[model samples]
Target: MTKKVLAAVKTDVETIEIREFDYPTVKPESGILRIEASGVGGSDPELYRKAGHVPVIMGHENVGTIEEVGEVAAKRWGVKSGDRVALHEYLPCWNCEWCMKGDFRLCMEVDFFNVKDRLNTDRFGMSTANKPPHLWGGYAQYMHLPLNTVMHKIPQDMPATHATLAVPFGNGVQWACLDGGAGPGKTVLVWGPGQQGLGCVLAAKAAGSYTVILAGMTRDQSRLDLSLRLGADYAINVETQDLEAEVMRITKGRGVDVVVDTTGDPKGEIVKQSIALAAKGAYLSLNGLEQQVPIGEIKKRYLTVRAPRGRSYAAVELALRYIGSGRYPIDQVCSHTFGLAQVHDAILATAGRGVQGAIHVCVEPWK
Candidate 1:
């Protein structure tokens, strides 16, 4: 049978291509589910622009249904061939020291989307594209997920649509709240009220942060408002207000206890202002992939920086629990959904920058 999928062939280009390829015959090498619906994420923009290299199949976040199972994987996850699940983007090398230590995120040898073929050669496991079509991408009609990378089972009662944000939202939860030590008395300054930043806001609040400040441009008003509703103590428009000064004033000149930047544009003056507004010993967590951080200034300020690689299945599961608990409106975050063919429109909407919450571009592959 032939597999149909879309691929970014060159810098600034996309095309739907078809090829004779094997479908995933095994769902459980470790415990994997055939993807039902894969969601697009911000990291995709870099691939779309070919910022690093050419011919990249650029999607990571996804949710799916189990089509097949390996005996070992089935025993471990307790999932059958028909269960729903979530996929963790980072594929770790199980033989690595980090994997042995249970710190799969730190695995030196990691396989992302396009590079899957280098690790697995089994049928329907992970393959490379020597030509135009790449089945490794989630844009395909069917996705081949290797056992080592899949994580989390979506409960039958939960909506598969909301579960799509499990990865990105988990990122926000892990960085700002869990790793940053957000608690009853700490003040958190979350820069950029986009999906990730808003996730931080929700996580900080869930973790009992005393003060949550969302900093963003005037165009981000929609997200800022949603942040306030989610749990932000204050929303500061950096374009219309002095962000640093406002944060200082909010903290009574003590500065926020922690600063989280998800804007991905660190060299920008606004990010510098966030640095200036942070307490001398404050913690700084960066989630934006596009920004280059100023290490020198961070050193001068004695900032305690914690960089998280990506959300694991465990972290994503935790976020799902928090969402399921009814404390915050996780379901409200997905402001949009679209069919696979509508991906261009979805990207345009997200890139336009007025989304009130997490702007998810959903793909209904079966549709």
Candidate 2:
């Protein structure tokens, strides 16, 4: 095995630098992963642009092969070298109530943003890289997999590039189907045509929703078109058309049964519109950075507002199954690929800046 590992480290806001780290020595309770693909999601841009934690390696959605597994880790994770896996970002304390309940994503110990003192928290991609065994993120050739790391085995037939989608797909299943209650004969309105929004489109459709309407801006024409191809009943250009009027017309004035907003638009215009577009008693699954909501309107509509945090263990398992099923052309969502050297450009593409018509971007360390 190589003694040194290369990684794209986010040294500061809107900045990335290639750095090298000593290969981590696998302890009896830890392992190592040779990263194949690291997905760049919508939040990646925000993380890149915003100034918070510096000197962190920021690739959360990771897929790779197990390179080194300690004796205890091998038995604990039920895997050995050469096993393909998808790594979850959260590293929870197993003793917590949430962790015991299998909702490790909610465990407070892994809440890096809320907790102070970097050593106390350990979230992949978000934690500072200054710590020892600093391979904490996926923008690297190999990542250290501590015993607390949560991972799902990818099907043998699925390629690493496709398996990189498990994060968004898991979120889609969690928000659209599980939380939003989208099912047979239901109507869903997805307020963005980005990767997460498109994933929700597929999740709603797969759950037997009769109508799935995906709304986006003029720049997202290609994404909107792709939504239609991936089982969306309608793709609305919110920039060109009157969103409320079009939605009312499609629902015959009743509004949709569920509304999922993944735009992460700080203006909160879509959140306001979602209130008017939702059917009475409908569920609204919201995933955004910041928003100003009209609480009175939500209360009047009796809407069940749900904030989807992270994917549950079951959701990740289901996502792997969905990815392996040969269902939708999910590979198409991976619109751009970049090497470790082009980490900055890859993030720019994900942020809709450098690359045109880019959707889901992947960073391949070895490339």
Q: What TM-score, computed on C-alpha atoms, does each candidate reach? A: 0.84, 0.96
Alpha-carbon RMSD to native, per candidate: 4.3, 1.7
**lDDT of each residue in 1-367, candidate 1, tens digit only:** 5533443222334332233344444533543345556666766554444433433333466777877778877776677888887777666668878788876766655534234443242212123344322445554455655556557877877766677778778988878876788779999998887777887888888888899999888778877887887899899887798877787788899888887877776565545666788787788876444555588888888888765566555667778887667666665677777665555454455666433344555554555
Residue 97 shift from truth in candidate 1, angstroms: 2.1
Regions of model 2 farther than 4 Å from truth: 117-120, 287-290
Residue pairs with backbone overlap in model 1: 28-70, 36-64, 264-291
Clash list (residue pairs), candidate 2: none
Clashes (backbone N, CA, C under 3 Å), per candidate, total 3, 0
What digit string (tens of lDDT, one per residue) describes model 2 on residues 34-145?
A: 9999999778898888776678898999999999999999999999899999988999989989899988988988875578665346788888899889999999999999
TM-score of 1: 0.84
User: Which candidate wins on TM-score?
Assistant: 2
Write down the lDDT of every candidate, Cα atoms only: 0.66, 0.87
